[model samples]
Target: MDVLIVGAGPTGLTLGIDLARRGVDALVVERAEALFPGSRGKGIQPRTQEVFEDLGVLDAIRAAGGPYPVRAIWKDGERIGEQPMFEPVEADESAPYTEPLMVPQWRTQEVLYARLVELGGRVAFGHELTGLEQDAEGVSARFADGSAVRARYAVAADGGRSAVRRALGVAMTGETVDPSPFLVADLRMTGLDREYWHTFPRPDGTGLALCPLAGTDDFQLAGKFPEGTEFDLSLDGVRRLVAAYTHLDAEDVTELRWASDFRPRAALADRFRVGRVFLAGDAAHVHSPAGGQGLNTSVQDAYNLGWKLGAVLKDGAPEPLLDTYEEERRPNAAAMLGLSTGVHRGEVQRGKATVQLGLGYPESALSEDRRAAPAGVRAGDRAPDGRVDGVRLFDAFRGPHWTLLGAPAAAAGVHALPAAPKSYGPGVFLVRPDGYVGWAGDSAEGLGAYLARAGVR
Candidate 1:
């Protein structure tokens, strides 16, 4: 196999789809016997929506989810007022997706997994990784059932308690974002309207909220508790907690589907790559889940690494091209960790920062700007969506190949757009497979060298 992915969550499944579409042989393994049965990580930010579009799962995702509802604050069983869940941002031509969508994490995984299988990819359920070893050439992984698989590279997407990360002896440097424990669950309930998120805040600085999960008949119940409290995960415990906090009785909670308790925290892996092993998703970084950055950041990590791996393993790119994964993603992960912590502590609002449309890698070794006067969309920036010369920019960049705009001549494998979008200013742009401009110039003067280095010619 070209790659062994350790986990079948959104991160690993997404990587599997990217690699499979690129014709790279990759396998995803999950310890769980089935997909996770919960509504955790329920927010899908705008940037991730673009990724899903490129992976060809956006329509299914949109069909399976809905937009976030207004928060309805309640005091003493009476509705005080309504507030927006996030700062509203208008959608424009350059940036089409503006707001976050509410899709249960399990549903999101289902969409990604289906797309992976459509691309002829496979995931091995019940394959629990026990040991991992790496050499100069490849990585060897051993499962609990005495089975072994070797691949040219391995990715640790097994989540925050990653067994693969532990095997590689990579440390995570982080701290607790909140000392207080919290409970989150998906359950059917009554006495709450489906149009609004019901929130009940107490005077003691602790409260609970019940939000109707979009595209489902369940409500996601989240409650904050005092430190040192041992909350129960049972249905009865959830009923009692809800009855105590809300106006409804315990019986209002009709059925419990899934429940889990956790303390919000933020942590990042000390390193993303260890020889032939790389860390992606929750295995590499743990977030507080406040600004909905954890799963999105994890998915983007897979996106940033997928093409580079494809370039090296298939296109004969130099090995050093792999090093940019850490140099580009680690710092971005660190910034997201801080943003997540800030949102959890009410230090930052979930507006533009959480949208993540502005993220890019301007300082990476692969990014080249030959233009003397760079403006608007420059190298290392995300290529915006627009229509140029009667061709949609996103449509031109939808495949597992590079895109060159404002270039008349065509390279062998690169997609060339004769005209640049008005929003892109006057310059030639080479958009990477991951949709970031890798090189920019006044003309196509230095485009050949950049494409050669990226192994795109």
Candidate 2:
């Protein structure tokens, strides 16, 4: 196997599918044999949907589920302000893919699992990664089966304990601040007028939030608490909260589905890559699910790493490209952490990049001389989309693959692939499989210059 993936959850499955789609040999090993039907997260961000569309999973996702409706916040069972969960995305036909759509996390996982199987790569069930040993060329992973498999690299998409990360000796450092306990319950709401999100506040001031299930009036209730205050809500406890928070009564609580407690965790690994062993998704960083960014960030993390790993392992192995896995993503990780913990991404990232964001970095091998900006969009950054022949390429066509967004003639300097986007973002821009602008070219000269610097020449 080219890569051994730990944890057959969303992130691992996504990584496996991406690598397999590109003809890379990758295997995902899960501790369990069957797909987890209990859905923890149901809200798929629009940005996430954009990614799904790129992966060719959006239509199936939308068909299986529905859209994410605007949700309401609540405290002590009282309604408060609504959140900016989803925005109206202008349907841009010229783009590679479409905007966001919402679905259950299990649905998302199932789609990726099916796709991986379709691509001739399957997730090994009951193969929990218990240990790892690596050398200069490859790594051998020990599973609970008392057997081991060798691969050039390993992706630790496993949950927090992360056997792969520990084996590699990567240090993850951060404070577990505000240990605000919260529980998420996913289920269908019955016997109520199907309306927008219903929110309420906890009077005791422990914590508060109420949101509509993605695309429906079904509910996902969130409650925060300080220290210990019966954080885990039982079916009856959940029913009580629903009744107190809204006018709905206990009898209306049709189903008391899966529920679990989690602390608002915020942390970042000191390193994402250590030789052949790397980390992606929750394994590297765990933050509060408050902003609905955990799963989305994990998907993007794998998206960013998959192509680079494939490039290095296959052909056109640019040594410098591997270094970018940390340079570009570390800061991005920091920004995500700051957002969840209320640290903020400084003024620049907040004011400019927060909206029309692009990537920025100081030490990217992709950006040598010639003075373009950094790798990812930070503060004061405006996101750049693509266009071709005066036609704008929107979010409909983007998938988890390399995309060219200009006339093949105009997009010189970069890899002159046979197919390209007619009208996309900036002039001669190279979008990472994860949908961030990696290499930018203003004109033919800039394109040529950047390609030369990036060793694409």
Candidate 3:
């Protein structure tokens, strides 16, 4: 294959789909025989949805995952203010796929897998990347089954304990500060009065939460057990924690499913990529599951890099374009890690309307205009989806395209911008394919100069 991707988790699968859509040949190798199950990543952010829309599977995703908003409440023996839930996207903006969806990590993978299949690509389940060796031309990989695979480029989407990262001798350094234990499970509750999730502080570390699946009435609960006590999400642990925390008696409830005693960790990789081998998703980052951003962030990373990789392989994009993957994604991952950590430590409460939606791309090729805002148009920023004057830019997270939105030089590309050049000054603007402004004139009067500056010859 042209590209070899390790680990068919959410990130890897999504990248595989993207590569196929771009007409790039890709093969994904996953260790597991099947995709993940249950509700691991329960929340999805607006940025993630934008990536989905760009993939052209947003409709399927919305059909599979949810149009539901996941909420967080204080467990200090009382409820508090909640984010004022609004429509997925406001009418004034360019971002079409706005709002978070509450779906399990496994289901997200399933949707991505379907997209890949539709695009004529398939994942190699049960085939694992045991080791890897790379040189100038390409990367050679050895699998657990005594098999080898080679490709022009290989992405270590294999996840946090990436075998590929280890083969490259890349070291990760960080503190496992809060190694708290929590019992988690997906069970079919016989019946419940209400349909919302709950988290309360009990005598143990943290009381717990019952996040129900998006469509099904069945519920999944996770709670911190006592330090000295054995932890398990088995039927016994569920009954024990539920009985201890809530007044409802769950003994009559059948124990449908159970997850072994597991402790999710929070940490970050020191570096993301090394040489010809690139790291994406959990292979490049690890963090707490607060806000359920882990899966979402990882999937988005794949979305950002897959197109760039395809562009490099097929369109002869510049080398610097690939470097932007780490430059643009690291900070976003760091931000997500920070927010998730606060939630894990119970340091702060999260609202659905938190500015997580406004997360932007901080890296861009555009030169800085002293008078212009540093992040006026960035690499990782939300690619606004809407209309520019009478022209529609992005229906979703549309990115810069050479095929469209090209102006002579001084015409500025601004979404829903109606101001005329006379009133807006002489500056010219061009919108990127992703619904971001690429070139900007000094002022409305600088239109010709701006076009000249941006090489709009």
Specify the highest-lDDT model's number: 1
Q: Write the per-residue lDDT of candidate 3 for residues 105-164, one digit (tens) a residue.
A: 666777888888988998888887777898888889998899899898889888778888
Model 3, C-alpha of 324: deviation from truth (Å):
1.7
Model 1 spans with C-alpha error above 4 angstroms: none
TM-score of each: 0.99, 0.80, 0.82
> Where is the poorest 10-residue window by lDDT in model 2?
344-353
**What ranking emerges by lDDT with the best candidate at the front?**
1, 3, 2
Better of 2 and 3 by lDDT: 3
Scored by CA lDDT, what does every candidate get? 0.92, 0.63, 0.64
Give the count of colliding residue pairs in each prediction.
0, 52, 29
Q: How accurate locally is residue 293 in candidate 2, as Cα lDDT from 0 to 100?
A: 58
**163: Cα error in model 1, Å:** 0.5
Span of 10 residues, lowest total lDDT, candidate 3: 396-405
- lDDT of model 3 at position 44: 67
